[model samples]
Target: MSTPYRFPDYQVAGDADTTVFLLHGAYGSKDYFREEIQTLVRAGLRVVAWDAPGYGISPLPPEGLSIERLAETAACLIDREGSKTNIVLGHSMGGIITPAVYAARPDKVHGIVISATAGSFSQKSAQDQETFLAERVEPLRAGNTFRDTAGAVIDSMFAPTSRGPMVDLVREVALSTPADTFCAAITAITRYQGEPNMRNVKVPALLLAGEFDQVGRPQSMQSVQQQFMPHADFVCLPDAAHYAFAEQHALFNEQVLRFIRERVLAQA
Candidate 1:
């Protein structure tokens, strides 16, 4: 279990009927959702995004366990927030956690948004990822700096078309994460297995992937999407890579909010 994680910086939008819960990817802090939080708040929906244990301000887990524990931790936080219905969104590794939240407490989350992530980890790829995480430690210890380290990984996370402040912000935020914690998160993701459970999710879902994503590539996402609620909508952001949310913020935000309004909030 994770230590109690606080999201003191999350701004509540004063809206009475809707809440938006966002989870960032591995190597990301709560700050990853800064724009989404603000956008949802401004759109009159209460926003709640948190830094999971071992990332951002939250304490790291003792064993550096898998993303399953992180997903459970997030669901606990959502339960504590006192709303039984809200929109739950996750990106990348965070995307892997989204379904866990619903499975843990289906009553609390009315919808889900999974960006640039898949439910399964292929055996061969998982092994390769384990190797990469194990190997990156020396460079990280050699004063390789999160900024430079993050730069190396950025090419795999976003589309070539991604540019502007959001791109820079993603890099900075990725670098801000403690290197060990980042690696540990990756290790956990590699061993994770929860997508099969997503097949039972009853909430409305919006699945989006970038056309050129290299990390949580689009093809894997498509395979995962087929396991989602049959009624769930899936879309591809053109000219985008893995970080489609940052690559196309305006469009991403619009599609997300509109989906929530139509599928979750409107029914409520």
Candidate 2:
């Protein structure tokens, strides 16, 4: 018999009619969505941000890290906190997991927002995948922790012009990730075949890409839209990179709220 999966630790805010589940990236926790949470709450939308397994205070799954496992956990959380109108919003690695959550529980998800991620790692060349893995894991093998590499990693995810307390907030969130978690997440992410899941997203969908995002480049996301999510709305935020939600919070929030209002809520 298998042990029941443990739900990750999460934070809830607002009491609005619509609930937005915020999932952070590889090196982030619920706190990474702090700005988004506040903004969404102020905009009258309920928000739930989670610490993906092995992140923040959440315990790692006994079965280890996999995108499927992450999707299952997210589905369970949504079942618990879901509203009449539920929107699952994910960034970077979390973005890859969003569609999987929809595949897991289509009835519960009314909308999905995939931010700063490509459709699948399978789409990348063998050399690109290897380079991605080596860049993240090599430092850990060298006895360095996420704290040691957080600054550089975070710096690379933002637009060159982006700077301020938001940058500091992102750095702090990245620093909190455990080395084991970081390594496991990078491995799981690289191995994920998400195109099938992406194609399965039948709900109202929105794709947000950072204009300067090299990690999940805007061009790649555009390709993803053409191939799998043709029905979904796509927006490339100007002057923003992988961390567009923080780098350009106002624009990011505006698009999200707009999608919910026009695409998701209007139908309701």
- Give the per-residue lDDT digits (tens) of candidate 2, residues 158-228: 89988878777987888788888888888888788999989878889999999998788888888898999
Superposed model 2: Cα runs more than 4 Å off? 1-4
CA lDDT for candidate 1: 0.74
Q: What does candidate 1's lDDT look like per residue over 1-268, in tens digits?
A: 4343333233344565677887888767877677777777788788777777787767776677576667677777777774646888888877888888888778888999988876555522666456556455556767787667666766566776688887877878877888778778767876877756578788899888888876666666776676555677888888888777778888888889889888887777
Clashing pairs in 2: none
Query: Which pairs of residues collide in model 1?
Result: 54-59
* TM-scores of all candidate predictions against the true structure: 0.87, 0.96
Could you tell me the TM-score of candidate 2?
A: 0.96
Candidate 2 local Cα displacement, residue 253, angstroms? 1.0
Alpha carbon lDDT of residue 114, candidate 2? 92
Best by lDDT: 2
Count clashes in each candidate, considering only residues at least 3 apart in sequence or on different chains. Answer: 1, 0
